[model samples]
Target: MAVNVFASATEAGDTAVPLGGSGVAATVDCPDLSERLTTVPEQARPDVDTELARLDEQIAAAYRQLQEAARTADDAKLDEGAILDPLKKERAGTIERIAAVIGKAGKRPEGLDTLAECTLRRTEVATTDAPGGSPDQQRQQQNGKGEEPGNTGNTGNTGDDGDDGQTGDGQQPGNGGQAGNGPVAADYADINSVRPNVVQAPRQKNASTGSFATSCGVNAEGLFNSDNLIAAPGVSNGAHHFHDYVGNQANDAFSSDEDLAAAGTSCADQGDKSSYYWPVLRLQNGTVEQDAESPGGGIEGNAGEIVTPAEVTLRFEGNERGEVTEMPRLLRIITGDAKAFVNGDTNANASWSCTGFEDRQLKDKYPLCPSGSDVVRTFTFQSCWDGRNIDSANHRTHVAFAAADGTCPDGFRAIPRLVQRVVYDVDAPSLQDGGRTVPLFAVDSFPEQLHKPVTDHSDFINVFDEDLMREMADCINSGRECGPDTPPGSEPGQGENPQEQPTENPTKDPQEQPTENPDASDPPAERTATASAPAVPGQDGRDDGESEGKGGGSGAGRNDGQASAPPAQERDDDASPRAEPRAATTPADDTPDDASGAAPAPGATQGTGGGEDAAAGSATEPQATRGGLAETGSGLGLWPAAAGGVLFAGGCVLLIRSRRRSM
Candidate 1:
């Protein structure tokens, strides 16, 4: 379903919705996000049982101390932060110890070489790794704290298969020809129904399938970490946690317009040199506190503020399918709500999509893409801005999803929709690896927590020529097929012929994979209109007219949006792929000829800490190591464990009071 790109573009004029109040777009360049998955390599995979056990023990012990302190503070009527600060400090120290062990082991998956990567791996492996890895432990902790904002039945955690009634893998990939099972967040009846009182205009008119359209993009070979991070100014390296970066190969937190202008880009289309990044979510090694802290951090299992996704893909597509279009200058927009971790709800506008198989639309979640299909993560940003706020407190109020009929809102001015499709190199589903069929990845979230993986999000910045943007908008609004080779004023079919569009190749990526049994001949999905969807706060993926409070409250209420996802009908299997998904042409670990993998990535933090003090380990942090990696070590003994028991008791008391206060 190609959307009307210009919903009455010209008529919208200057102050109209698509044009922003003054026919102008905010001048900052950035972008938004979405997700899908690819498997990480398993070679040289070190069994971190010993390291994890030690880390878990330390975390438990630390939590015990923290509890005891909190209780003591309560008894003494002291400030909780005062009592907890030291314990928090200790917990950080314990985590650093785990980093040390990871650093020295050097047996982790090859591509996941950064701390963030290890963090992600560790997190996924946590359920199976630690002594605390048991559900009993999790329940016990929850019991200690009573319950959290979204801690009921793990709402969307409906056993991957039961989550979305469409059958396997949460929800059917493309139900009812709808090629998407975007991350299902909590109910957003409040926001979706009334806020965007503005009506949509008609912008989409082009009918091209983009078959001959050139596929220009960037591939983030590996994550980077460094002291020159630009987001965390004045801070060393980056934040306490690292940030994943792509696009400008040389970009760091400290990168500048001039630096970016001068730096080489990873994009096949060099003209698209904008930098992309977000906080890297680290999977906790057993060496530290891996479980989500209550009132301690923002979300449950809060390893970091955000879950590090497996990959980041970015691209552009519009009415000018025949040629490429240069992005406008410094136009930035973040999609999906970052505060979701804090809010415990999913923003409906995060257009979660899947890639890899041809024919099938690019936005289906967990679709079994055919062989040779590129595994793409395409995030569509909200085009209808309030024009008043660059960002809202909730990270959503300022934007909104486009009308399902493809119309721009009354307050929004039509602009060329920018789609950022990040491609991961994961291969088709691997049958090996213990008959388990190596699992596909998805947008990261606090594991086992109410907020499931479906809570995918993204950020974007438009750094293109303004004139070029105007031209592209004109192309889209006017329904013209313009490309880099054919600007708006050029004659039809007389523009520069672009190099042959890259064939949909999935093997270039080391971890990139495709579906195990693809449903063939599936035409492109009709939900592509999500490309220009409005992304505003409280727009929690609910229909515009959904009545308020269908099921409002904690975790379960938030999942009401997702509850609708499961009931979808599965794709008809009788249908076959127009083109058969072929077998992997290369080995799972094959590095491409033009491939970019090298030694430890620049700016990416490599593990060097062992089961000891990580003070001298890496550039990210400085903390003391205690009870270095071990499984009930003789050196550390049962002292910490014993102490934890006492603290646990005190913790229960403090929490009881805390819950009362919240009530």
Candidate 2:
């Protein structure tokens, strides 16, 4: 039996036909038809197609499942087992086969003739499953330990394994390499070797007196009563001990019993009895401490109680003498929270006077009141003490203060007050003869607490008048006048002179004279040429001259005759001569020869000369010359005769020229 299949009759016709019942057949009418009989070997074709369809459906299902798994397996919700297990197993087997082929193929596997289909198929599955897997996970799957199939296929790991071929969980030493067992374990055997030693020290106490404990420790009563307390004969010495200890040392250093008694008396005079009544209190630390004292103790006794008014003795050393002075004046005295009269009363009843003891002069002056005075008093003294006065020669003065009764009050102290000597140390070179000295007065009161005097001595002034003169000189030198508007007796227009104005006067220019008259002869020749030509006649026998004249006896003939004559000869015979020498010497040749031929006859010369002279002076001199020529021609009849001759010659030439042309 046989069966046949054909694409077309043209292809089938060349092949032999099979038996009808047992083999495939193609009808002659349907040349392109193909058939397979049950008896033929191709009859199993339908079963083969069915098997292939089943296999294709299975492969398609597997591919779709793979795609669905890949789509859903993001890092956030990956299913490592369901997505990568089968692929990892397949990749391991494929890698083993590839390695075998590569080993047999030697250095270059590219030239080897081998089936790579399995390898490519396995690679596609492995790559899709292991797309972003970590290297360690990939290496674990490569070794065929039946590791969970979900393990990604990747590069093999080269790390050494522990027991059971697994890496140790313990951290390794030195770049994370595994530690050598025995040596590393033995190195840290003694735990105490690595422990740190620490010590705690006790805190020292603070010595600063900022706290109550420190301040309480000081002997307040002893400190307040220091000046009044007596001491034993021998105790502490040399060191800066407490006042009581220092007093004890002072008591021991005295040489005699009298000296010791005197020291005791001075101490008793301090009158600080409050120190004996105050009790010492024990601090919480069990140390004994002194209590602070109140006011009215020691020398500051009964501060508000006013005693008899005490004199504030002021001693001024080194005061300049005999000049009006300005200095700090001790006007009143201030005690503890109270002010009292030192010298003057509230009505300013105190008077100030200075007496030059050596010069025997008395000066009564009034004290200048300061701003803060409560009591302004004045004293009227006839004269001051000798030692308290100063003069120009006596620059230094020592002043001593005395009470009204000339005695100080008991238990009151007085500080020596100094009024500086007002001596001018003149710096000007013009004042080399030496500068003057004067006395300065005390004006302001002494302060309750005294401070060191200011020592800068650069600009000290003494006399008020001298100071006034210096100020005036400065004002003048600086170009300034001092007054309400300007100082008295100053020049009114000083420093304000007006600027002067300038004057102007116009000056005349020199007039220019004619250097030389413009060349007279040159101008005339140019003018003559430019003059209009006169209306005159030609030599033809036309009326070439004027016919009118006063005497009309052939005037033109007479003019012609005169014009034809020689002008030089006529000029020689004339009564009056011409002005220019060139005119006199000019020959008849200067005029045309026809003028000689046409000159007036000799009889008419007199009348013509007058006429010619008139015409020369008139506007038509050329006409006059032509008239003279015409008069000459008419008188001789030469013009008419020459005309006839010219006509005859013209007639003859015409006749001959015509005959010649005709012939």
Q: What C-alpha lDDT values do all the predictions have? A: 0.29, 0.18
Q: Please, what are the lDDT tens digits per residue for candidate 1 over residues 459-498?
A: 5545444554555554433333344334335323211111
Stretches off by above 4 angstroms in model 1 are 1-217, 220-244, 249-252, 255-263, 278-328, 339-342, 346-348, 351-376, 386-398, 425-452, 478-663
TM-score of 2: 0.10
lDDT of 1: 0.29
Q: Give each model's clash number.
A: 109, 50
- After TM-score superposition, what is the CA distance of residue 250 in candidate 1 from its true location, in Å? 5.6
Cα shift from native, residue 499, model 1 (Å): 26
